[model samples]
Target: MHVLPQVDSSPSLPRTKRVFFALNDYERRVFFPEYLAAELDALNGEAHWRTDELPSPAYWQTMMQELQPDVIVSCWSTPAVPFSLANAGSPLAYVCHLVGSVRNLVPRTFLERGGLLTNWGDIAGKTVAEHALLLALAALRNQPGWRPIINGPKAVPWRSGTMRLQPRSLYGRRVGIHGFGHVARALIRLLQPFDVEISAYSAGVPTGLMRSAGVTPFTSLLELATRSEVFFDCEALTPQSTASINATVLAALPDDAVFVNVGRGPVVDEPALVREAASGRIQVALDVVCKEPIDPASPLASLPGVILSPHIGGPTFDHFPHCGQRALENLARYLRGESPEALITPELYDRST
Candidate 1:
């Protein structure tokens, strides 16, 4: 009789399952909340110190060679993994991300090698949607321009007989969204209570989809822009969409309209946006800019109609542990030989790449 190796399939997990946390202390503080950290501590793992500034490939390779971690957990602050780590000799089997977009950090080769990658997914979208709403309301009220006139050294001193257009409220306004996506959909759901007329333009997506989501669908982006009192750009940032919103698109927005962009900055022509907002015809609220940590001298910084937040629309504090919990759930499934939810498919890889 031939003897075969027995597979250990038990409800009790392997205590020796190795995990590598690829983030420094600062990253841990920012991304890995205390609740999640405690959960991670229960899993057998070694914490590796690494920052984006010094993404030493050698350090990663050395750690992998020494510890031979079975899984890795990382965030935006973590550096890209070395391609060589996808080799058959490599012990790496899976990666869990707290961040949303993985195209930059996750190499296509890793996916090709049958590696599993999971992320926060819908958790990220919902939180970003919340920030988008905050910005829209702030833009509608022209809150950015208020601070100066109220009290600072730049106070306007309450002029005599100089009148202007009153800021519009989100209620009863026509809201148009360009690129109906997860974030846009969330925005619509949140907007349901406000009783705003909603219209959306999604390229390639069927018009009926948006209609079913309780929003009117427009054929072209220009038509959506022309009809909207407030316009949102929630399009994915891809090669096909870089700077898709140009001066012409900005021109299409109605006079005294509010333009809010929590999406990627490259989609909009920064110069054109500055010019339009400078004219006082458009109130621009942006969470992302063409260039991040915008220069102090940048014209957009001085514009009263423009409000800017430092790309903080996602990965909120309360959300850190939520992503970790989702990742842990998927990790459990992966160990059980079941399909891990949120695994990046070839189709998803194509859309992002």
Candidate 2:
């Protein structure tokens, strides 16, 4: 494997640390260019821009060899190039667009080989967890469908009988979190003020951590579904987790239970979830879906008692600036001979990969 040459401070060009940006044309044209321009103005004439649409692995490899950039800023779930790029010397710092799951972004080999990975996980995790909590609250109060009616002009003369659903308090309700990852931890922290009991299920988590979080560790998915009033899917998508929430698990839940999925869509069986919602056995609030942009005719779209969002749980203006700054910070750290803060390791990969 090739390694990058040592930085030379006493050079002709000052070795201004060549960095490249890889993102789609639209993102480059709209969001990132201004972001890069503002945060990277200090680099001035040093930074280079390359806007490509899903460049092939060969194209990336060739570009790496030619430009020999000190670092690359990737804006997406996964970089287009193979792990060999890291092995071939140039380090890449990933600035994820949104959050929820990282399984699709980092390859197994890259994690095993110690690739530097940083994300807006701090911001995204907190934001999405709060969003999920809001959805749960909405469902509990039966405000999911009623809010739209009250907000419209017609609501000014609305009759009381039209919006008569008993609202329940969230206190004392059991909240089950599936997959004890970064987002789950954030959610647990956020729920501390609500005085709610918490439970979680994660194959990778240690008993000590679960105990520390004050969450009951459930050994089986059935237990998580059957016991909790609100079941939150915070797990990532992997072979082990794909379609993990099936009909059997859904059947175990209470008839009035609320199901919230802020995780990967594939982790839950969409059809089974649709059936549960359609049958009035469960209420669902989905921020992610198996098929993105959800097809118009999909059962999930028309399911009664389901609240759908376009997978925008983690996107906020606050998130972007922080993520961009963190990505740059990680790159700077790598350049300064220090390890990046959120470096992807074999252990993190082993869980999802």
Candidate 3:
């Protein structure tokens, strides 16, 4: 087994740090090539970008032992064993691709061991929030079933006794944000132009900061849900928060109320949501699901009023470059014996605890 030695503590920083990139096969093909090039240029580092072809954990261990990179930047979809191997006192940064909790993808043991995590929170915030807003707008406009009308030039005559669609303007409407993290803050900023009344529910967030961002803080989740036309779930996933969206909360939503979830799938109860959406009691737009790449036969897919996307809330052309630049900057800091801007500390890991 080959091993790369740790960087020596010297006054002068190395010109180039040997870094390893481990990612899923799809990410490697679709996103990593450009990201790798950009990251190399940003950090001025010699990168060893590897796409793992091995079948099992043993193969990954072998590869890590041989590469012995100074730092490892990885996606959550890849196996954690390679990360565990490389993280034996080595600098490891987990790069978040979107706005979802990390608990689902990373093991508790990994967090306990002091693994550093980073994300494109600042850059990807507006992008994900915009996607969520788009979903809400589509739901409000009743666009899911109007594909034929939109695609065709023919206009249908209005019929009495049919549901009269009154488009609701976001202006002056109360918007409730479930989580007050980076993406939530960005969403609040975006909503400023619309003149919507914004309120947020968070346990640890400072009230002054939220107020400064033009969001009114709500102490109760139930109150927040009861009062808003649109509710955006941006909270992280944890044991407590997992399956947090229950029937009672779903029951409180006013008729034609819209639920936008760009967060984790497990954060909302899919079965309950399906029931509510099927009844036409509440509108739902989901970009994430409890099961990713949801099976074609899943009831959520066939539901009449639900707008389902294949977990693409954070996808945009800019995400790749933004993530790459942040990852490289973190690597550069690690080479200089300084903490990376995106580095995750043990305290953040303990947030779940």
TM-score for every candidate vs. truth? 0.84, 0.82, 0.80
Better-scoring candidate (lDDT), 1 or 2: 1
Off by over 4 Å in 3: 1-17, 23-47, 51-55, 82-115, 148-164, 350-353
lDDT of 1 by residue, 1-353 (tens): 11112334356855445556676666566555655655554442433434444556787667567767667778777767666665566767788776687887778778887888877777867778898899889887768656555654444445421233256678999999987777889889999889999999867889889989989999887888899998988888877678878888889999988898988888888899999999998888899998888888999988866889998998687777677688767766765667777777655665552
Every model's Cα RMSD, please?
Answer: 6.1, 5.0, 4.9
lDDT of 1: 0.76
Give the best candidate by lDDT: 1
Write model 2 residue lDDT over 120-177, tens digit each, in one string.
5556778888888888888887766586666667646656525465567778888899
Model 2 clashes, total count: 0
Ranking by lDDT: 1, 2, 3
Cα lDDT of model 3 by residue, 48-75, tens digit: 6555553377877777677655555566
Between 2 and 3, whose lDDT is larger? 2
TM-score of 3: 0.80
Give the candidates in order of TM-score, highest first.
1, 2, 3
Q: List the residue pairs that clash in candidate 3.
A: none
